[model samples]
Target: MTTQVQSGGMVNTTLMGGGALLVVGLGLALANLMTGGHASFNSGSDGVTWGLPVVNYVFFALTSTGLTLVASLALTFGNKAFYPIAKRCVFLSLITLVAGFASLALELGHPFRMLFAVPLNFQVNSPLNWMGVFYAVFLVLGVLKFMKLHASDWDSDTSKQVGLAALVTECLAGGMLGMAFGAMAMRPMWYGTLVPLYFLLTAACTGGAFALLMTYLTYGSESAMPEKVRALVQGPLPAALAAVLGFTILVMGYQTVIGLWSNADGMQVWDHIVSTPWFWIEAGALVAAFYLLVSRSSLMVAAMLIILGLFINRYEFVIGGQLVPLFKGTWVAGMISYTPSITEWMLTVMAFGIVLAGWAFGEKAFNLSDAPKE
Candidate 1:
């Protein structure tokens, strides 16, 4: 059973679980997509749809950037402590990046055009354009790096040099994603320039935690992040990451508070985020993450808290961004905002399923469980 688990059994399980989830999720998402577009979801009201779907995409994309960098750095930088956990992390990034794009495609009216014709059709300064270009560059660099790593016998030194440059580019692209949204004055809640900085920090925290979790689960105990690996990731990494997350939360909350005190609409949305159940939920996860990190618990406990904390942060970023309505010169509460329709939920589930399926299958099929001997 253990041999099979290390070989084909895991793949079979993932395919069964993730594959089924994907089919149902995508089916529902598609149905929702067909109905929502070509007409206002709000019945002639001109308001941007803000809710779970878009937030989910952002969470996935941002995480992709962080995960990619974390993985690539370990592989290429000769960081032995970090190396056992780097493999498949980049593959995971690529998978989730596709998921992000998939969610965004469902949300847009002309999703297909955004890939090609939209650039020629639209202007340069649009935030979407910046995001498009950044995503484009990351996508291209990702492919190039993948090819170089997998194509032929690139020696360790060469691979490291090339990987460093490519991953660095990916990081810049990832930071732009946050900057693009946060800089949008149209949404004052998102207008802080530090948004990029905030997002980048969270990405690292979550990405590290994710890598740690996968290391334990995918490989046996031998594959579990060793003391050295944990020291490297959860220690200095989290210590620094926590500072940054704390900073962003402080800055973000401060901005929200100031915005509310000064403006009517700001206050309404601020009230919603601060006073609602969601607010407490987000805060609780974040606080717990800190609790684990700061406390002298088992490394497993600390890593789990950090990972869950980051996940909760992702959820809040998605939902909170949309919770505050930027309408009527004053925000309104009591209106339950967008929930992922069943289809929307399914598509997301499917995307997740596909990733798990791929990861599990790859581990069995291709020896993804083994770290790069490089």
Candidate 2:
């Protein structure tokens, strides 16, 4: 009883703290809008037009998609191990996607206009347009699926069907998100078919990591976890994570090697990228994360490391692509520099604040444990 009370108190404290951060972030975002819009951001006409907020958007968006995909293993594929926490994954997916939208809202000059423009002005050739549509569908399907899961006590054919639909939509959305960058022929660094596959791979990694982290947090320790959940986390989950991390490492390594060997103007940015301390930090984090997973040292630590590495990886990908000025030698001299402003950082805080609060609320309101069999 004492332990339960302590846990409740901790959750309440987290909720309040997250709420405060959200309020502060929103205040800063409003201040930014009033004070000349994009001027507060570090982006300029010549370089890095898509800055930190964009990175945050991509990070949260892909994480949400990944969560949906991972949840499908239980809901759609009938993976018994995942059944215990599948609902929580769905909940997190919805919250993270909303947080992503919030970041995007702050990034855009007039976010409200998009609500009207996107639906009214259909651009068939636009990957972004299709991406938006798919995500919107995903959000709707996810909500319906969650509702059905709760209504049917977490086991029903209807919920499974919806989960499958959500999974498909999430895949389409994630792929289109990558295509949004890959299709830009002008951005030579980003112009490739691999980008979409890379996005999906990293998405799976993040999703799995998040699931593991949440499981540990919810249960407190392996000993505290139910036998079924413990078995899943100890055996299958870690094995899957290790495999994905290995693939990610291979892809990233090859990307670096190929970039160095190429003489393309945009590929030259890899030379600069490899020299940066951040790049090494990103690589080190992933390698360390992989080691932790493989050696079965600490799943929580590995998850944290993977999340951090992925954030840095996304940051480098977005910023590095724009570093090499499009009109090199003619207008720009060398690589462009970018540092996210205070406003952008605060907005990131806001997104995390939302996640923290949402998770706490979900824990408080819902029974996240394995559903009782009918």
**Highest TM-score against the true fold, candidate:** 2
Q: State how far residue 58 of model 1 sits from its true place (Å).
A: 0.4
Candidate number with greatest lDDT: 2
- Model 1, 1-374: lDDT tens per residue? 00112542335666678777777877766666676653322212223355545666777777777777677656666555555445557666776677777877766767776667875777766666776676666776665555554443234566666567657765776677777777777766566777787777777766665565555455434344345444555555556446655664565567556756867443355665666576666566666756655553444455566655555555555455555555633344433355445655665686676666666665655444344443
| Candidate 2, poorest ten consecutive residues by summed lDDT | 1-10
Ten contiguous residues with the weakest lDDT in model 1: 1-10
How many residue pairs collide in each prediction?
Answer: 4, 0
lDDT for 269 (candidate 1): 58
Candidate 1 TM-score, C-alpha based: 0.79
lDDT of candidate 2 over 1-374, digit per residue (tens): 00121243245666788788888987887798688687888888788899999998899899998888778887888777777778779988998899988998888878899999878889999999999999999999999988876664456667777888999999999999999999888877888987999999999888888788877767677877767777878888888889998999899999888888988878888998899998899899999999999988798899999989988888888888899887757677588877899888888889988876887677677655545363
